[model samples]
Target: MDQGLAGLIGAVVGITGALGAAYLAGRGQREQWRVQLRRDTYGQFLARTKRAERAGKAVRLAMDSGRFEPGLYATFAAAVAEAEESLALVLLEGPWSVASSAEDVVRHLDGWRWVVELWYDGDGTLTLERALESAGRDEDRFTQELEQFTNEVRRLLHGRDHTLTARLAYRLAARHSA
Candidate 1:
């Protein structure tokens, strides 16, 4: 082979390798950004949930102990509001499975908050005991759903596929809709 042709071939290979590496590097950085964004959104959601949960617990304790502080309900409402705000990120960025679970968690949390609010806002018809019991049940269900959501997120972060149950349900729902 001619020396000039050999040098040209070597240069071409080197340039091709550089381009390939750059493409791969760019792809890897994009993936990392996505992962970081997911983690941040998940963390925000979980943090807000925990804050709301704490406020709810405080309200429950107050109700159970027959002491109604003026600001406790407001605090719980604020926490729930913060949580709902954070939920938008989850809905926007999460995978379908994670988004769905996050939605369920938010719904359950809202349901619990609504029940608590009703006890406070109603025309004095709801018994405290009954309201507490119902709220307790809702909170329990919310906690369970949140735990499941957290686990789903963990699986997603680790690059696991959706659970079989989720896939089956999605397929069944799609089939029914069709």
Candidate 2:
């Protein structure tokens, strides 16, 4: 090949490679940002839920055992409210499945709250023991849903496609794994 032609071809190849690398790097950075956002959102959600759970447990323990702790109910109520508010973050940053799971968790929180209010006195048909049992079950369900949501977020972070088709495939695979 002519020297000039060879040099020109080499320059074009170099420029193309550089542009391709830049494009790939930009894509990688974008993915990283998405992963970080998800991590932060999930972390906040987990923290809020844990706070609410702990408070709820304390109140339930007091109610069930007839302790009548002065601030337990108030603390639990505040924590539950905080947890509910944190759902906005999940809704904003999370995938639909995660948002749905978070919503389910919030529903369980509401149920737990209702049980605490209705039967905390131990006078209703719903006894304190029954309420406690119900709360335990609700917690179990919430935990499971939270686990699934967390797993979904992890999968997304690890480069699982976020398209609906990919979600269906992932869910199906997850079901098989389970």
Candidate 3:
């Protein structure tokens, strides 16, 4: 074999190897966005749930203080809306179960929104204590369902690991008294 030809062949093989390496690296890098998105979706889910819970608390506090301010209450209502949007996006993005779970999130946020709105804009028709009681009950039910929904998402995404569920619980628990 000619020495020059051998060297040429060796160079080609080296170039091909480099290209293959680059291709694989690019593939892995692409998945980095997926991993980050998944993380963001989960983080948003937790944040939204916590925000909804806080909004409910705010409603209770406002009613107790007898302060009727629609704009102030709207902030909490807006959080519920933001939470709904995040859930919707998560459903649209991936892992399939986001659809079902995100629906649950939307439903819960919707019900919770009323309570926030009631705090500021509710007519004198219904008794504050009664309405607050009803909202609290709804929150309890939705919280249970949200836990289940997120658990399902976690099960689908993480298999046996319950990291998503745990994080959500930790956030809710931390804010329980708040």
- Which candidate number maximizes TM-score? 1
Which candidate has the highest lDDT of all?
1
Note the residue pairs that clash in candidate 2. none
Taking all chains together, the TM-score of candidate 3 against the true structure is: 0.71
> Each candidate: how many clashes?
0, 0, 0
Q: How do all the candidates rank in terms of lDDT, highest first?
A: 1, 2, 3
Can you write out model 1's per-residue Cα lDDT over 57-87, one digit (the tens) per residue?
A: 8898999999978599999989999999999
Q: How do the residues 1-178 of candidate 2 rate in per-residue lDDT, one tens digit apiece?
A: 9999999999999999999999999999998888788888887877787777777877766876789575777787788888888899989886888888788888887678767777755567987678788888886776566566656665666656445554465456445533
Listed per candidate, the RMSD to the true structure in angstroms reads 8.6, 7.4, 3.7
Q: What are the lDDT figures for the candidates, one per model?
A: 0.86, 0.75, 0.72
Off by over 4 Å in 1: 160-178
Between candidates 1 and 3, name the one with more favorable TM-score. 1
Question: lDDT, candidate 1, residue 121?
Answer: 92
lDDT tens digits, residue span 1-178, model 3 = 9999999999999999999999999999987877778778877876787777776677667767887566656777787778777876677676666567667766866776675555446686667777777777777767766776667666755666675766677566857758
Q: Judge candidate 3 at residue 89 and give its lDDT.
A: 67
Superposed model 3: Cα runs more than 4 Å off: 1-9, 64-72, 115-130, 149-160, 163-172, 175-177
